[model samples]
Target: MVLDTVMTTLHVLVGALWVGSVVFVAGAILPAAVEGALDAAPLEKIADRLVYLSRGSSVVMFLTGGHLAGTRYTIETLTGTGRGHLVLAMLALWLALAALVEVGRSRLVDGLQEKRVRTPAAEVTTVFRVAAVVGILLLVDAGLLASGLALY
Candidate 1:
């Protein structure tokens, strides 16, 4: 019971951090940088920092989520239950989020590091917009899963 509670808490907290960072980057930071409200140097720095933070959160989510699934659920429960389906959906979403972040980091951060020139606003915007949409979906899915309504 204690392990259950601890793993659940860790999963939720890390998930929130991951989603929140994506939203902030995509919605606020990227837009501000694009519109010239924020400086490019600082924006790049923020993105660099978030790359590590986001990766760390993803690792935590995977660990805690795996533990919860392994301990609390059986193959029958995972395949037969509504919550099981939700868990599967959430896993898919998590994979998508991971891919999107990796692509964004490679394109946005790598470009910045390799070339001293500022990354094009349009490129940043495009990458971040996709990531933001996925991030929002993750949050909504999490909400539904938590409420036990994800499969309904």
Candidate 2:
């Protein structure tokens, strides 16, 4: 019973982290983007901060998920069911997040700091729109995983 409760709690915490990040990016960050407040300097700083936090959170979630699945329930059982789909979704999101971090750092931060490029409206719009889509995908993935539907 205790083990079940602990797994449930950890699962909930991971879901919160994933969903909360998406909510923050969409509700708060997207508005800033639409308003053009997501320009060079501010956007660079915010991206840097978010990237770091996301990296750590992703690691924690992956580790915890692996442990819970391996220790509590057999990995084979999860794979036999459709839970593997959720895991694959998570992996895809993690890849997207990693790519976003790399691009944000290389282009936005480096370019702005080095004056290689100026902050343009079109570029900002593109970046934010893509990020918004990714955020929405992440939210959906988290919701599906947390719903226990994947296990059915």
Candidate 3:
């Protein structure tokens, strides 16, 4: 029971950190950078730092989440229960978030290194929009999971 509680707490905490960072970047940092209110250099630096944090937190989340899933639910439960469905949904969201962040970071780096040329605002906006949507959805799903509604 103690182990279960610890794993759950770690999973939620790390997931929160990951989602919070993405939302902040999408809602604030990207917009400011795209609008020229922020410098490209600082934006790049922030992105680099966030990439490390996001990736690290994601790993922790995966480890704890996997443990919880493996220990708490059997294959039958996973396929037959609402909580299991939520788990699957969360997994898909995680994959989507990972792809968006990795691809966006590469593009951001390319834009930043292009001889003082800013990455096109439209491109950044697209990536930010997609990430923000995914992040928001993840938060909502998490809330449901926490509320036990995911077991419905």
Candidate 4:
């Protein structure tokens, strides 16, 4: 029971951070930059800080979420069970993670570092658009799973 409580707490906290940060970055921060309302250098700096924050939160979510699901929930329940919501939530998480790593870290960073973008304005806008969409999806997924409404 104690372990259950601890794990639940960890899972909830991590999930909230993971989801909330993504939402804030995507919905609030990105839009401002994309609209050219924010300066490019400041936006880039914010993006860097957001990346760092996301890394830490994602790591915690991955670790705690794995433990919670693996220890508290059966594999059958997660996959084969009639829990379609859980399945969808899991799939969304996976997709979000993929977007973060492949698109955000690798592709976005590579483009930025290589000076592939015609201007800092263009690059910032591009990154903001992609991150905003992906981040919003990730947040929704985590929020659903964390709420326990995803279970069968």
Candidate 5:
């Protein structure tokens, strides 16, 4: 029970951190940089930290979510129920979110290598926005699962 609580807490916290950071970068930081309000140096630092956070949070989510799912479900159940499908959808959303982040970051990194802020920010803005959307979907999926909506 204690382990369950701890794992759940970590899962929720890290997921929030990951999603929220993505939203912030996409909505606030990127816009500012593109508008020439923020500099490339700070943007680079933010990108660096975001990459670490994204990688770490992805690992943490996989571990905690795996433990939770393993305890709560079997292969048969996961493959054959509404809740199971929701879990599967969440997994898909999670992978999509991660990939979007990686792609955006890579573009930003390559653009940064050219020492241009607005262009890189402009380049990756759409990718990050899509990631933000996926993150939002992931959060909504979690909410549905938590609200017992998936039990239908």
Candidate 6:
């Protein structure tokens, strides 16, 4: 029970931080850079931090989420119930979000390396948007799973 609480807490915390950061980058920082309100050097630094946060959160979530699933679910339950389906869907969203974050950062990093900022930010804006959307879906799925659904 204590393990469950700790894992759940860690999972939620990391998810929120990573997702919130992505949303902020997509909704504000990227736009600011595109509009000439920010510079390439600072944008590159922020992108590096964003990538680091995303990677760390992804690892933490993978471990904690895997532990939670192992403790609470089995092959049969995971494949045969609503909550199980939600968990599976969340897993998919998690993978997609990870990929999007990596790819978006790659775009920004590559652009910054080539001595450009606004263009790269503009190019990667849509990717970040999609990632943020996926992250939101994962959070919503977590909520649905937590709404007192029967545990298997």
- Ordered from best to worst TM-score, the candidate numbers read 5, 6, 3, 1, 2, 4
Clashes of 6: 0
Candidate 5, 1-152: lDDT as tens digits: 99999998999899999999999999999999999997777888899889889999999999999999999888888899888888889899999999999999989988887889999999899999999999999999899888996784
| lDDT of candidate 4 over 1-152, digit per residue (tens) | 78767866876676556556655755676565446576545555665766776677666666766766667667667766545446447657645654563344344444445443334434444554565566566556656765777556
Give the Å shift of residue 47 in candidate 3.
Answer: 1.0
Candidate lDDT scores, in order, read 0.77, 0.60, 0.80, 0.57, 0.92, 0.92
Global local distance difference test of model 6:
0.92
> Which candidate comes out best when scored by TM-score?
5
> Backbone clashes in each candidate structure, one number apiece?
0, 0, 0, 0, 0, 0
lDDT per residue (tens digit) for residues 1-152 in model 2: 78756765776576466546545654676466546666666756665776676677667767766666566456565566576667667667666765664454455566556532334323444554565567567667767876888874
TM-score of 1: 0.85
Better of 1 and 5 by lDDT: 5
**TM-score of model 4 (CA atoms):** 0.64
Q: If both were scored by TM-score, which would come out higher, candidate 1 or candidate 6?
A: 6
The list of candidate 4 runs beyond 4 A from truth reads 84-88, 91-98, 101-151
- TM-score, cand. 6: 0.96
Q: What's model 1's lDDT at 55?
A: 84
For model 6, the stretches where C-alpha displacement exceeds 4 angstroms are: 149-152
Candidate 6 lDDT over 45-133, as tens digits, reads: 99999999999999999999999999988888889988788888989999999999999999899998987888999999999999999
lDDT of 5 at 42: 83
1-152: candidate 3 lDDT, tens digit per residue: 99999999988888878888888888877877767777667877887887898789778978998999999888887889998888888888987887788778778878778734245444766886797688778878878888996674
